[model samples]
Target: MNENEAGERQIDIMVCGAGYVGLATAVAIKQARPSLDVVLADAAPDGVWKKDGRASAIAAAACAMLQRLGVWDELEEGAQPITEMIVTDSRASDPIRPVYLTFSGEVEPGQPFAHMLMNRDLNGALRRRCDELGIEIHQGTPIAGLDRSGACAVATAKDNRRFSARLVIAADGARSRLRDWAGIRTVSWQYGQSGIVCTVAHERPHNGRAEEHFLPAGPFATLPLPGNRSSIVWTERTADAERLVNSDPFLFETELETRFGRHLGAITVESKPRAWPLGLTLARAFVTHRLALAGDAAHGIHPIAGQGLNMGFKDVAALAEVIVEADRLGLDFGQEDVLEDYQRWRRFDTVRMGATTDILNRLFSNDIAPIRLIRDIGLGIVDRMPGLKRDFIAQAAGKGGPMPRLLRGEAI
Candidate 1:
């Protein structure tokens, strides 16, 4: 580590975001290359992650990466495996929403394709592993400015403390200031829809089954959780979603019940419903100079496929692998040429997923008779093809492309 004349603290790497991707990246790299110094700085206050009641779908490959990072054991107990998934398309008022497609089976012999895990639990687990790896975490310290014109990138924190590192990573969020500061452009647009998220308790078991109902407004997904509770991602027009979430308790439950159905039995809202606007935000470039963007900083897509977080995990895996390998070869991993490998490996997949979710959202979130008929037929055909279903399950499990060491359950 080297310090400049201005008293800037220097480290090998500086990760600007304490979200899962940032935490996982720090842990993955530090665990593999202990000699390298790594630090994480977040804008949020300490313990703020505990209040996130939201949960995410962790694909099989992401699960393996977390396990390799020594964080999964802490999260495994609370995680709920998704044994089956069924998709249906119909109006909200439909009495019988027929299942047009169903997916089941495992990528491996015993491991299911995906699992549901609370965001807080996953973040806590990753944070704990970071502590074990001796990574310094600075909370409430946001990046105020970034200067990459020198030999090393200097990140100025909100508190005026400067951190000089060989490489700076931005994993902040979709609207990333670090990404902008680095002069990285993005292609983005709002979907005019918002996803209303909440947890619901039911009288009967969900049997580890996940359901995605394609209503006129958008997809309503109920992902199974521990016990008789399930997590809901109900999409609707922005105005309608805002009104529903802010409306009275009785009204929210009544509206939620209409789409949630009776299969799970008498359902009760267990958490405060929150609505998040849906959109697609993809960075034009994942890296520039000595800076690299990860997680939402790189791309944000619709939750129609439940691959948002999984895609971020893919960024963590690929970035960590590239950085670690480059360091092993005694090369400056922060160089643009080195970072380009990461961008190349991820850009196509990110764009593909973004385009796919966009098409699905547009194709399903409507009442057009001709489009509905065509989509239903497509779903029916896919349902009948066992080979095609297996391929989809594998893709959803994060097994579509070249496997990274961490994602394949191997140490970097």
Candidate 2:
């Protein structure tokens, strides 16, 4: 890694937080402009992502972007395709949970809407690409502060080391320190709910079908993983979530069985159950001065639609395009106009998705008879209308609206 010393440091871009978005952004930019100097840093030490047992749904468009970055071929086999999805609303003892809506997951020939893969696999691939691109990584280091008063932004590390760059990308998590340091405010709220995530081993295969059961408390999703295992995202009241997460294994499995059903035969938890607070967090502005926010730093929405990570990937694609173009044009990449282009391109989509997920969570997380009837009827209508369903499928596949060149598998 190149520190470049304090008074003479020169770098094109400095990306804070080595999470999925940070690494991807660094790799994408360096690959597009080999002469540019890029550096990625994270607070956590190296090999920390290996301990993350969670998985995510990578949408088709995100897959294409990864392929363009030379990371997808390594991820292809480790990913389990989601060929179909079914939604239902009912109680545990209702005899049957009527499927209100169903979707055929192909966005095109041989392309599925999404796939389930472990977080480590995705991060590892991006890290390898970063190495291949000669991008420097500052592991176990955090950007303590940013000094933007000079011609170039100077990021001061916790260890008192500094790196000067024309642009700074904050890919930190939802509670981003860089965002706060930049004087950026956010619109945020908690859902009074929590999502309990865990992986399960089953006797029978899920057959690439994902199921969502909207019970009184919240939505319960069984997403198909590779082999006869499936990943569970069960939403519940925050208090109840605490109890289940801290309860004995036997009690946990008992409650899980009630909602999981016997269709998959016997099921056992294969990983530790963890609960994450549900919420909506959107930055008031994505760019200010020479700094820009990406990933969860810009928006955090309920995972009901499973678009959180994919949306972050979209931000990566758009920001990379904007920055690369400005650099090639011999313009100031960190200028307000250049940064505004990225903000404009991504803000509308981010706001729309945050609102959509909020509405879905509110409409389905309760058991009011009247509201249930209305939503179920709405779902049925969507199911019966093939054209409407196709539109929705395309939207979920990240095929709707204007796409960045990287998302279309094109080089920036």
User: For this target, which candidate reaches the highest TM-score against the unseen true structure?
Assistant: 1
Top-lDDT candidate index:
1
Model 2 residue pairs with clashes? none
* Model 2 C-alpha lDDT per residue in residues 117-152, reported as the tens digit of each score: 999999999999999999989989788888899888
Cα lDDT for residue 360, model 1?
95
**Please, what is the whole-model Cα lDDT of each candidate in the order they appear?**
0.93, 0.92
lDDT of 1 by residue, 1-412 (tens): 4677889998999999999999999999999999999999873687899999999999999999999998888899999999999999999898999999999847878899999999999988988888889999999878899999999999998899999999999999988999988888999999999999999999999999999999999999999999999999999999999999999999999999999989878999999999999999999999999999999999999999999999999999999999999999999999999999999999999999999999999999999999999999999999999999989999999999898888999988
**RMSD for each of the candidates:** 0.9, 1.3
Q: Against the hidden reference, what TM-scores do the models get?
A: 0.99, 0.98
What C-alpha lDDT does candidate 2 achieve relative to the native structure? Answer: 0.92
What is the TM-score (0 to 1) of candidate 2?
A: 0.98
